[model samples]
Target: MPVLHSAIHKIDKKPDGTPAVLFLGGAEQVESQARDDLMHQFNESYNGTAGKGWGFFHAESGAFPLSGWLGKYLAGVGDFLKFSTIAVEHLVRLMEESNLTTGGHALFCHYQQGLTEYLIIALVQETEAVTMTEELSLLTIKRLDLDHIRLAARINLSEWKGNPQSKQYISYIKGKQGRRINEYFRDFIGSQEGIDGPSETRTLLKAFSDFVESEDLPEESAREKTHALVSYSMAQAKLGEPITLDELSGLIDEDRPKSFYDFIKAKDYGLSETLPPDKKTLNKFRRFTGRAEGLSISFEAHLLGDKIKFNPADGTLTMRGLPTQLTEQLKRATA
Candidate 1:
């Protein structure tokens, strides 16, 4: 990663209805190996985190307009330090208004990976821990709690600039369900949810299933393709990247590179060219297949506990609601 600029500022606040304090860093470029490592680790954690929302920035207005400030910085009107200072001040104000108690060191990094540029903003907290020194003596230290990143957002500068009409250029961690505590952080960035990750993932899986059935692929071939799909999606999720349909199609079958892509296009599944994979939904997706001397069975893993029951000891499966065609065939044969 090539870091164009990076800085860290501190915000001191408590949920006890008190004023928040802001500590700004100097306006000098802070580039170091430690910074690189921190950015890399942060990217890994952010990529692995689930339940992120994707959207574009809100209109640039109000007391602390983030998009306007970012525009000035990007247009060469001010240095990154100036930009971050204004942004953190806005965050402090918003935190106060939201009555949020949590505060930490806010890190702003502008970096380039491959041909794409990105801006990552995260609020990191520190935890105290005991460690051993070179002499084997115990020592107390403060370390960044990267494992529990709550408030963070990354902007795809390349996409935002190149694709002016795109809505998923910004991705952010959206706390747990039924909680709006992180809404303030999103408002600070001026982003609204534009893409439903889970729904999109489900659609993709459904399209893949339809493609498999249409192809009339053997059980082994179907299983292999399913694995390919999941593996590619998970890898993209791990890299904080979206799954490109054409690219995924190529990966799924090199022999017929455009087979899946063409299938999806013909079916009109309403999928975007690229999709943000939902890890949770992907984790729940599985296909179970079995073939014996003269029997064949296949079903989605999710239906096991509901529509289908299995007995491991007896090596038997009890399925409800057989296909209408199969039911008619059995009825005719018995009659």
Candidate 2:
């Protein structure tokens, strides 16, 4: 539960005048929570929700890291997680926008990184032991029978990293490059390999079987743009909402996948790629609602900045007495 943050703290007043964040830390720190709530209140005295929270802050660099509620990724133990880079980005952005991010990160744990699972599985094929279904199942009262295919499917379809790899499993997670095991998985396991037979179940089965037959895997790729894939996968798993096509496309930065193969998989029940007819843009009405509260505060701040006198009746802001030239300059600046 310990959080890491850069050493610098304190927001200094800037001569140019945009508000700079001071006193940075993980946003979940109770004291930081209180402070952000106060800022949200000023930003929205009329709006509700009590200004719950914001993304956590990094002190020295001032970067706000997304909160980690997605369960810890399990590594070395199994294959899964590494496939969900897009989902992870979306998760962080959603948390930041909603002001719900709490700021924690996974060094590693419980779920597998999907993108890399296959190659590692292939590499380890010769070994005496495998991370078989019996070892990783999180079965409940409702389900019976061991499920390796679906388990692998979910991890591959989900996020990119989990943790605690032993010497045997370290390479995939070596530098946190999600693309590694993932590319091969896509190239080898989850790729659109030809499937035989009718049932979607049959297709999945064929895919799994075909994967076990691929070539010896290569080295893992180096990562770019440090990602928050684990965070997103956890959010999507928890929310359980079907994503819109646009949202899905946005999530991966990739052009939408050419075929319906991902959607065709049987294990992905309740998942959706259909987009709303009127694609969601911004919600400006929500913006106007919050502006109602601090409109006066903003006006007052504006007044203080100028040596101005105001008449109660006129809606216009004016300085009662000033030299014409200076008044004109102030009016221009205000405008």
lDDT of 1: 0.89
lDDT of 2 by residue, 74-139 (tens): 323312233223223333343344333122221112222223331111110111223336778654
Estimate, for each residue in 147-177, the C-alpha lDDT of model 1 and write its tens digit. Answer: 8899999999999889978878999999673
Cα lDDT listed for each candidate: 0.89, 0.25
Range of the 10 consecutive residues with the lowest summed lDDT in candidate 1: 175-184
TM-score of 2: 0.16
Query: TM-scores of the models, in the given order?
Result: 0.93, 0.16
State the local distance difference test value for candidate 2: 0.25
Measured by lDDT, the strongest candidate is: 1
Candidate 1 colliding pairs: none
Tell me the deviation in Å of residue 183 in model 2: 0.6
